[model samples]
Target: MTAALFGHDGPWTEEEYLALGETRQRVELFDGSLHVTPAPTPRHQRIARRLGNVLEPAAEAAGLELLEAVNVRLRPDRIPIPDVVITGPIDLDQVNIDAADVRLICEIVSPGNAATDRVLKMHYYAEARIPWYLLVEQETGSLHLYREKNGHHVEESTAAPGGLLELTEPVHVAIRPERLLD
Candidate 1:
């Protein structure tokens, strides 16, 4: 179910991928291959921003850093830019933040790249041992929170527009799915 957007002819090294700087589109590395996705739509950006607004104060109260669209180096060959990440303090100058510093990673599912957000990225985040993963469905205005257990992800909870999306691990926060959609 994975698409080979780049490195179709052969595998690519991490250094080679990094050299292609400031792309207009989003690029990710998986298993020594490159996956490029188009820029997110305005709606997607709005949702991500709203979710960040809700999370920022909670994260700050818990003494965690809230970041958006930052590169996470899960491994030398695997670097994925998560839409939202809550983690410990990080050095801004670092090329890519180590996955070990990450506590929770959230992705706003894009209409065109839903599979990459729901499937591929889920597998990669679980493999990285990130404690919590949040999947925000752009079309349905729902949120699915998964927790890592035994090196895999288990659906911890889910909420629709009226329901509250609450989390205790990584940080304590409560948000409504409807707010994320607006």
Candidate 2:
């Protein structure tokens, strides 16, 4: 695996970093290191869109906000672009306006990213103390909903075509398993 690169430490501000322009691939900064991710595949986009379709209506009804493929600052100089992110309704300034303020994060695993999402990203999200993390695996048509329990991650529920997923408390966003594959 190629090592991620961190920008040289200096007086560079967040606005300066965010304003930097690039016309190539998507890049992320984790601990001041640059991590370049491969372009998402068509199947990846399909799964992400399907998830949004189900959640958007429910979120709207609950007065929540839906952000898609947006860079969420998880820590200072560290940002990870979740496939689907949901937070409480708020003005732009009150939301994830910088490198923090993300409540729930989701990632749709593509071919090469399956292992990394399962291991690296999984641990990253857990360590970040995100209340809820959702993982959708296209190959198995599986949806794994993880809730933070006892300061660790517990697979609260798994749903496939025949199963029904319950969001439980808090966000209370639920959708049928098959809808995720649509």
Candidate 3:
């Protein structure tokens, strides 16, 4: 009955993917496949929270909002719940938002899925033409900022340990990477 409803013979459509309701893990729809990722660790939550705190003021000043773990539909067939995102005012009742509304998307690297964040998602976000992508590596307590140019992402800045992550685009904010962890 379930398979019949979703049509297993063809690629999952946007309607079918959105109808997934809720699941145990983070699920993203890309092309004809579903990308499932395990739940984040408590530490991952902490970093996102800390980043939001520091970024909120600047984001608000620029008339953008900092949101965590919200679904962003990059296209009719691509939607991924980015860990953190900065966007213009949104309808609170919306289930998800268009990627065009997103000013910056952040992904915290899961310990075992570093490549997914560093390589795979980077490609997706870049391909989606998102202006900025921020990656936080928990193991090294480092932050890497990439700016999309042409059709790919280029490293714009990096902050690690005693260094500071500073940026003027998307929003103007600066903070030490160590503060994000502790």
Best by lDDT: 1
TM-score of each: 0.93, 0.80, 0.92
User: In terms of TM-score, which candidate is strongest?
Assistant: 1
Native-to-model Cα distance after best TM-score fit, residue 33 in candidate 1, in Å: 1.3
| Stretches of candidate 1 exceeding 4 Å from the true structure | 1-9
**Which 10 successive residues of model 2 have the least lDDT summed?**
1-10
Please provide, for model 1 over 10-44, each residue's C-alpha lDDT reduced to its tens digit, 9 standing for 90 to 100: 78778877777667688888877778787888898
Q: Residue 120 CA error for candidate 2 (Å)? A: 1.9
Q: Is candidate 1 or candidate 2 better by lDDT?
A: 1
lDDT of each: 0.88, 0.71, 0.87
Residue 20 lDDT, candidate 3, scale 0-100: 80
Error of 3 at 113 (Å): 1.1
Taking all chains together, the TM-score of candidate 1 against the true structure is 0.93
User: Deviation in angstroms for 71 in model 3?
Assistant: 0.9
Work out candidate 2's RMSD over C-alphas: 4.1
Pairs with backbone N, CA or C atoms under 3 Å apart (clashes), candidate 1: none
RMSD for each model, in Å, please?
A: 3.3, 4.1, 2.3
